[model samples]
Target: MVETDKPKQHRSRVLEGMAHAVSQKGYGDTTIADIVREASVSRRTFYEHFSSKAECLVALYEAASHNSLKVLRDAIDPAHEWQTQVERALAAYLGSMQANPVLVRTLFIEILHLGPEGLAARRRVNSVVADFILSMVNGSKGPKSHVLSSGMATAIVGGINELVLEYIEQDKVKYLDELVQPASDLVHAITRT
Candidate 1:
């Protein structure tokens, strides 16, 4: 059991290191050495976990995305109406991003630099988020709810990503909360149709 936990712990540490290194140096400039150093692990340890720096960054992005989704999930108020629940989730999600500008820059902006691999990882994360949105919308108990098809759910995620990217590129990730209203409204409009 201890042996099993060691690899998992080392892998998680490397992912955390990748986030820290990329946040400090940008993904393009970050090196494996920097990652291991940030992780307080050796080069051999990083190699044990990831084949390359880009791979490590992708791993970190996926982990961060899941964590952010958890924040959204935990913000939900089941007793409230679905729309109110949606707004609350969005508020929590954006609020978490606003509090972690460096994380936003590393995961959001830096991931785009890795060509096909980065895009693939991003697509996977987006699909997961879309599925979560589908659950939230379709699982609600009311009319005009669950009308969301998977395609439409994915589209909504993409549209909101574009909105957030606009802010990220402008070094305004701290203002992510500004998107809560627009994002919730877009969901409302699309679901109503």
Candidate 2:
């Protein structure tokens, strides 16, 4: 069992280290040595988990996205009205992001400097978020074809992301929850049609 668990533990440490390194030095200046030092692990251990800085950043992004998605999934209550559900989910998402400002900055801002690999990871994360929005929209009652299509869901995700990015850029990540109402309004406007 110890043998089986070691890899998972090492991976977690590496991810934590990546978040710290990127948050401190930004992705452009972070190196494998920095990650290992931040993680308190050997260089070999870092390489055991990730091939490169970009790869490590991707892993960190994926892990963080997975965790945030869980918070969102748990926040959703099917019994509530659709608009209420959207508000709850949005609040939960923004709250999670606010609670982890460093991770959010690293994931959203620093990761972008990783070039194509970063772009690909970002696209994948956006697609996953869009899928969640699509599920929520599909579960709610709305006009058959007036709005709330997969494309619309993707667009909504983009808008929400932009809003969060604005907050991050302005160093107002704590105000992210303030966006819940506007975000919900945007989603509700389309779905209510």
Best by lDDT: 1
Q: What tens digits encode model 1's per-residue C-alpha lDDT throughout 29-89?
A: 8999899999899999999888888888888888889889999888987666667677788
lDDT of 2 by residue, 1-193 (tens): 6799998998899999989988889888888988989898999998888888888889999899989989998998777655656788889988999999879997688878888888899989889988887777676654444546788888888888888899899999988899999888877776663
In terms of lDDT, the poorest run of 10 residues in model 1 is 138-147
Listed per candidate, the RMSD to the true structure in angstroms reads 2.1, 1.8
Clashes of each: 1, 0
Which residue pairs come into collision in candidate 2?
none
Reference-based lDDT, each prediction: 0.86, 0.84
Sequence-dependent TM-score of model 2: 0.92
Best by TM-score: 2
Question: Runs in model 2 with CA error above 4 Å?
Answer: 141-147
lDDT of 1 at 14: 92
